[model samples]
Target: MNRTQFLRLCALGAALAVGGPAALAQTYPSKPIRLVVPWPAGGGADAVGRAVAEALRVQLGQSVVVDNIAGAGGNIGTQQFIRQPADGYTLLLATSSTNSANPYLYKRTGFDPVKDFTPVASLAVIPSVMIVAAGAPYKSPADIVQAAKATPGKLSYGSGGVGNSAHLAGELFKSIAGIDVIHVPYKGSSPALTDVMGGQLDYMLDTGAYGQLKGGKVRAVAVASATRHPLLPGVPTFEELGIKGMQMNAWYGLAAPAGTPAAIVERLNGAVQAAFQAGDLGKRLTDVGAELRPGTAASFAAFWNAELQRYAGLVKLTGATLD
Candidate 1:
């Protein structure tokens, strides 16, 4: 009779009309859920995916298994992911790169991020940091800019590869700062970071390199955020330093294949928010330099759209392309 009961009954009737496994949105996840992490094992995406799965498992009272389908810069796995049934049991560990940037960077992503997926909830954001050797001469963003201007093409930065977040950030910095620098692409971020630490490269902007920032291994000159991150409070943000349009963050989230039940999406998003509210999952993400992001499905969708637009401009600004 009450509004809550009426809504529940409506959802139940709709589920029954569909008449299948997806009809039970109220009691969904009767079995283990599959979380597809479109990245390699032992990587940042893998770690966050596993952590999210564990938290969801605890919150939903069902196991959440991880499946890594990494290749072709996270495009091959996504191509397969879109084929999954629009059931709540399957989810994608979505990232800014997979959902926002790849479409603009790659000629064929095989999946339409906007049309083929349903935004569930945003999990966390990993901001980029401009890092140099602990003993490097560049003390700040200004210092780096000065050196680049003086030496022109002599200053170089390394990245995981072309069209990667690091490369895009570096290019944005180059464009805004009006400096000439070389971009050295590597097979992976590890080797690129190694070159930075070994003095072979001048700087490297990255999200996954936070683990290497301790013990004076590297000096963080500036963070690509509107405000200072707790992990690096002493380091100023690019915005605060009078550099605009530098708030680059790699946001992670949970998304389901398009056409999934609205009740199911709401239920799963509740679990995501509850998992963060439980404190353990947020702490786990924070330990690795990720800022917690709690949002509804609607908000996540809006954020995704805005990010897609932003990435489109970024791709055009950098003239970055992948075959």
Candidate 2:
């Protein structure tokens, strides 16, 4: 009602408007954060999501809850995550399936991987292993290739799903080895791997087959890495086995909705670096056959961009699609 009162109110309003983001950054993660994994629970993505969330909980002094929203090859959950507030409270545990391959495989994924998210960190690279039942006749990659060539479509391989890294790896193997192996797509890797172990499926290229291999439930013939994985040192790489043009590694990363505050992104990146430095997370990831690849937000963004380009080429080469 008075000039002095009006002036004081305006000054307070100006201060709040100007200092809002800075103040928020200083007191960020004041409440619980949601870490969305665009895949089903109990899968590799969910495991990695929980691991990163736990580490961030200790570093950020806030609860980081993992929420799984699986469907449409990770497109459903990714679209939902992109629609959340860009306040950094909601983050996505992104994988190669959602970020690189899905965009090319699906006719419409409803969100741009590069434009709709802000990279936070690159977590790890998971190498896929060619595995068969413990009692299968195929003892090596060459044996499997020869059998497929001799029998044509008599031999079949299972994958987590169509357009997934496992499927693409199998396709790449078929192309390079010049063999005809029927492809069986399951809803998830667990089921596909189960079939492989049960002898219903001849073999599968899977990233999460380490436990089965170690438990003697399945035998690994070859790894899709340039070198042998330390956990599976006895197994050889595809290159070492004379299999060319078949190197593929699935990766996991953390990202926030686009336009998230740079300060929040930087803080999250720092938390990731600290998580890797703690040594426990790296060891746990390695135990599951994942190679830790901790890096900055900018570095992750660059890597993600390159992955997009690379997967685009692979998609074209394999003629894999999900319309």
Q: What is the TM-score of each candidate against the true structure?
A: 0.85, 0.92
Candidate 2 lDDT, 49-80, residue by residue in tens: 88899989988999999998878777888999
Q: In candidate 1, residue 283 scores what lDDT?
A: 88
lDDT of 1 by residue, 108-220 (tens): 78999799999999989899999999889988899999999988999999876666677788888998999999999775466788889899999988887777887678889
lDDT of each: 0.85, 0.87
**Which 10 consecutive residues of model 1 have the lowest summed lDDT?**
18-27
TM-score of 2: 0.92
State the weakest 10-residue window (summed lDDT) of model 2.
20-29
Model 2, position 79, has a per-residue lDDT of 94
Best by lDDT: 2
Candidate 2 whole-model C-alpha lDDT, 0 to 1: 0.87
